[model samples]
Target chain A: MKPAQFDYADPRSVEDAVALLQQHGADAKILAGGQSLVPLLNMRLARPAVIIDVGKLRDLDYIRDDGDALVIGALTTQRSVERSELVAREHPLLAATTRYIAHPQIRNRGTFGGSIAHADPAAECPALAVALDMQITVVGPGGARVIAAADFFVTYLTTSLEQDEILTDVRVPKLTPGTGWSIQEVARRHGDFAMAGAICTLTLERGRCAAARIALFGVGAVPVRAPEAEQTIIGQEPNAALFEEAGARASAEISEPLADIHGSSEFRRHLAGVMTQRALTEAFSRAEAR
Target chain B: MTAKRDVSLTVNGVAYSASVEPRMTLVDLLRGELGLTGTHVGCEHGVCGACTILLNGQAVRSCIMLAVQADGAELMTVEGLSEDGQLHPIQQAFVGQRGLQCGFCTPGFLMSVYELLQHNPAPGDDEIKEALGGELCRCTGYQSILRSVRDAAARLRGEVPAAATEGEA
Candidate 1:
């Protein structure tokens, strides 16, 4: 089906894009990879009056290693991120999960910032950001501010970003050398939105769990952080029992999981437990090795 | 009201300028305006890779892109898969390995395989499968298509990548 009529502007610079957004406010939508926004527009799920195409902003697409942090430009496409040598060498989990975002064609066009900005609870990048505790830089009329990953998601389709603000970049710190990460998701098809997914990263010291974080998607309005599960692994050994306990806590801490055509709430909760346990076990093993 | 934007876009190495409505999709412009019908439109959304084409040496969904958005951008269509009247190695592999049944989905598959081979001169079977997973073709079970990609990768690398074998029809 054809999309509703709209005005299109190809802004030559980031400032041009920002000015356009300032003039139009919420009536305008920033077009990046268009993997998410375009589909919504086509289906009339979104009816923006203006579309500011910022895909051509070359300055906004780079992956650089700035000392201790891996800074990714907001417009860096998924393909670029997945193929980044720095990302793969340092934060391989981010690169690995980037490979699973949609599919090859979409990844080639979809941007890292766009996916995070879209803030789909079922999206991989958001869960990745939450799991890794990345920082987002947002620029608006009031200048720019760095937003922490934990505070980024306000609600479903809601973010702390203001209307005139554009996400300029994301800074993700390197995982400690011994840290291990696992991202697992189940979708009806490979490229379809996930039914339920979990991303877990663990750091072990002397074979004891030093730190563990679990971020879940498709289990809540916004991607949920499994706090109770994280608490379970703080002082426990990286053993099967600890994994099982953390998994149970993960499922228990959830008041409700999303129920839709793909799965029941009960099934999602079950999958959460199963995937979290699997991920935690895998992560712990990786931590113990090398 | 503003007039339709006058934009010039280069498609398949040929350049042309046209006045297009701001809302016109790049797929429509390629098929309707420029008269290059290789880019297919399925779902009219990004979910389906049927409208995939190489934009500036990278694959992107034309359905989500406005013709104006692709202005002055280099694009390669399925029709441009050959050079000097010779079939691209990927196309030859698809033909040799029987990657098509109905052929409606063939163009997209070819473009995706071309991309995979470009980035990875030699891709393993799993890598080929991952690259082609985005496109869906019902008539031909993915077995033949996957083989075609492997064969194409072999041919592109100037060394055999995978055997062109079929276990089932």
Candidate 2:
């Protein structure tokens, strides 16, 4: 079925694109890769008066090493992120988690910033972003400002981005060498949205965890980092007992689980604990093996 | 308050231009305006990979992309998989290997396999399965397609292995 009629604008530059957004505001939706927004439009779930096609703005598709982090342009496709030698080596968790986004075809068109801006709680990227404590750069009528990943997702499919702002780039810090990383999810199929997913990253020094980050998706309205879980493993050796306690903490912290055709809230809450335990166990083993 | 945009795009090595409402999907523009009907559209919401196409050398769901989003990008449809009336190696393997039954899923399968081979010149069996997992086929299980991708990979490397038929896994 055809989507409801809407206006389209292909801006040549990011500046011009955000200007169009400034002009149209609530009636305008920025188009990055169209991997998500287009489906929403066709379903009539979204009917913006203006569709700003930013694919022509090639300048926004890039990844650069920014000393402490990798500054990825908003239009960078998940395929690029997942396959980049730099990302795979330095940010293995992002690269490993990105493979779970959909499939090669969808990943080729799905952008990193687009997924973060879309803020799908069930999506893996956003949860990784929150886990990594990345920073998002948003350009709007008032000029550019940064928002931490923790502040980005306000709710399910809802973000802190204002109507007139375009998410320009996402800055993700890289993991130093000898760090352990693992990500896993349970989905009905390989490319289906995850029923529940967990990303675990821990840095070890002298056989003890120096820092740990745990993020979850498809378990709540927004992908949430389990602070209690993070606290449990930090400064300690990751073991079966620690992992079990952290999983229980995560299951306890999830405010209200998300329910859909995939699974119920109760089911996801149960899965959150299971996945957390699995991811933690695997990541810890990798860390200890080396 | 519909807005119209003029977008000139190159499709399957042919240049075309069309002015369409922003609502026009890449699938619509390919079929309705440019007459590239080979890019099939099944699930408009993108769960199905029938509308998959090579957008700037990457496989993407055309149905989920606005036509204007594809402006100035190179595109390849199922129609582009042949050269001078000769089937591409992968396409030949599909036919020679009996990879299709009812054929609604053939276009998507062909495009996806093309991408997989291009990305991994000699992919392992697990890699091949991961690449094809996104596609859903109602016309019998994809046992044949799995064979076709591996066979095509060998043929692309100038090795003609005997077709791995039934119970050959």
Candidate 3:
């Protein structure tokens, strides 16, 4: 399938891209990597009147260690993130989770910011962003503003970003020392989108869970942060039974689990619980080893 | 119709220039305009890896990328694997290993393997599988393809003579 005829512009700078977005507004679509958008275009599902190609904005392709966090540019390809030594040393969770994305071919063209902006609930990037409390920066005609990961995702395939705004970068805080993390998902194939997934980070103090964060995706419109599940684990010694209880809490917290031809809502809920349990179990062992 | 844009790029060591519409995919430009039909179009959407090729030495799905995106990039296609009517070592390995049945998915596999070998001259089985994970092969159940890549790796690493693999075919 061929895409519908559309006017194209490859802006060289972020300011020029923002101006184009401000000009075309909702009628234009930003083409970064085009791993996801091009497929939609070929299918005629996204027929934007204008396409703003930001591929020329080389300034937006970087991975910087900003002391407390890693600042990744919007145009940074997933392949770069996967292979970054800084990411592997500082945030191994990011490197491990990125491998769950489609494959090398797609990762070579898919941008880290594009995945976050696309906000696909089944995607690993958004779930990891929510779990780690990452910050997203968006640039508009007014200037740039940072949005909390919790406020960034609005719903399925939707973000809080305005039509005239372009996501510039994301700030991922480094994991505190002695913190253990795991990202687990159940997908039809190794590279396919997950049916349901869970991301967990655990910090243990004196053999007791000091802090726990749990996030679930592919079961809701947005990545669901399991506060109740985290509460169940905090201040308690992690055991298989405790992990089971937290998993149940996480599954029960999903208000609206998505259902499709791949799996029913109930099945996804079950999978979310199973994934959380597995992730927590693994995270706890790693934390104890730390 | 959208206005056509001029693009000039190097493919398989040859420089080419062409005018393409903004919506025309890189695969379309290669097949229809440049007449490089080695890169087949399976799923125009990015799902199938049949349109895979090397852009700037990295393997990518050409079907999802616009022709204008390759304006200044160097590319490699399946047709570029051979030189002076001789099969490349990778192609020879695939033939020896019987990596294909219908052969429609061979070009994509070859391009992907070429990139994998270029980066990792001695990749393990898991590494090979990971590199080719996106490609879908309905025939041969991928076992033979896996063997072919392993053989290709050995051939490229000089562990196996190219003629030895070709003789096995």
Best by TM-score: 3
Span of 10 residues, lowest total lDDT, candidate 2 chain A: A88-97
Candidate 2 local lDDT, B1-169, one digit each (tens): 5768788988889988899877889989999998888878888988888888888888888888888777778888999999999999998888767788778878888888888888788999899889888777787467778878888998898897545465422
* Residue B30 displacement in candidate 1 (angstroms): 0.3
- For model 3, the superposed segments whose C-alpha errors exceed 4 Å read B161-169
Error of 3 at A2 (Å): 0.8
lDDT tens readout by residue for model 1, B73-138? 899999899899998988888877888878878888888888877878878888877887888787
Residues A11-51 of candidate 3: C-alpha lDDT, one tens digit per residue = 99889998998888888999999999999999999999999
**Model 3 lDDT, residue A171, Cα:** 99
Worst 10 residues of 3 chain B by lDDT: B160-169
Per-candidate DockQ versus the true complex?
Answer: 0.64, 0.77, 0.85
Give me the runs in candidate 2 sitting further than 4 Å from their true place: B1-3, B164-169
Every model's Cα RMSD, please? 2.1, 2.1, 1.8
Q: What iRMS does model 3 reach?
A: 0.8
Runs in model 1 deviating more than 4 A are B83-86, B158-168
Of 2 and 3, the candidate ahead on DockQ is 3
Task: Evaluate residue A38 in candidate 3 and report its C-alpha lDDT on the 0 to 100 scale.
Answer: 94
